[model samples]
Target: MTRRWPVVLVGPMGAGKTTVARLLADEWGVPARDTDHDVESLEGRSVADIFVDSGEAHFRELERQAVAAALADHEGVLALGGGAVLDESTRALLADHHVVFLRVGLSDAVKRVGLGSSRPLLLGNVRSRIKTLLDERSAIYESVATLVVDTDGRTPGDVAGEIGKALGERA
Candidate 1:
């Protein structure tokens, strides 16, 4: 069967995936779920805390499970964690879904992430890390995405509108 209700937003950190997903859900009048939020809700801890306490590998496991559960639970707009696409199983689950890959360049990502923040991965030598992560994950994201969106200078509303248009045309 063809799934028609859920729209999955995938992208790098600071790419406004959550914001765009929320707007899309609101515009489409569907519920919205973020995998990061799921991890936090399940662990009773913030993402930063999860990283600091449980380590990245453990946090990634939690994220993967959360993504799967989210996919299984509802038909709505799903905003995935930035790195969720790194897992092959998650990509397969999203194969037939409406996946939008929000693309943000390195400089833009650094600016949006900000210089002073509690981002676990961005805590040390974040610029290089962001570049490295983007390079490694861009291919995976591209492979799984049904559509590509460049959100370099667009507001959430603008990006939402673009996504809606794309969805409409494809649907």
Candidate 2:
């Protein structure tokens, strides 16, 4: 089925996709849906726990399904997991939507994410891992995005306002 969303947020970890989605939802008076949350809800566990128990491959499959379902059913602001674009089908689904790539510099991303074990991808050498993930995923994020918003040194409200303005222009 064909579907469209007011805004779909995509980026690497700590790019503020989730926070900005909620802010945008509030501004637009719509619900905010996150694929990561959906996956966690479905699995009844945290993302980190899913990674530990079922592995990245299993978690990715679940994420892909969650993204597909969210795209089909949700009409509100949607936020994707950092690695959701890794799936070809997910990228295809995003092509027809108003996708915003939340760009963040390496230092900002690391600072926002912190040296937390909660993130499976940044388990060791957090800075290096984030840098590598950002480097690897930047192009893919850009490819699927209809708009790009830099979140570096910006608040979630500011970013949401910018996105709201941009979406308004499109409307």
Best by TM-score: 2
For candidate 2, write residues 1-171 as lDDT tens digits: 232574799999999999999988887778999999999999999999999999999999999999999998888999999999999999998888989999999989989999774799988799999999999999999999988999999999999999888888323
Question: What is the model-wide C-alpha lDDT for candidate 1?
Answer: 0.87
Q: How close is candidate 2 to the true structure, as a TM-score?
A: 0.95
Candidate 1 residues 49-84, lDDT tens each?
A: 999998999999999999998888768899999889
Clashes of each: 0, 0
Worst 10 residues of 2 by lDDT: 1-10
CA RMSD (A), model 1: 2.0
- Model 1, residue 120: C-alpha shift (Å): 1.2
lDDT of each: 0.87, 0.91
Clashing pairs in 1: none
Query: TM-scores of the models, in the given order?
Result: 0.94, 0.95
What is candidate 1's CA lDDT for residue 81?
92
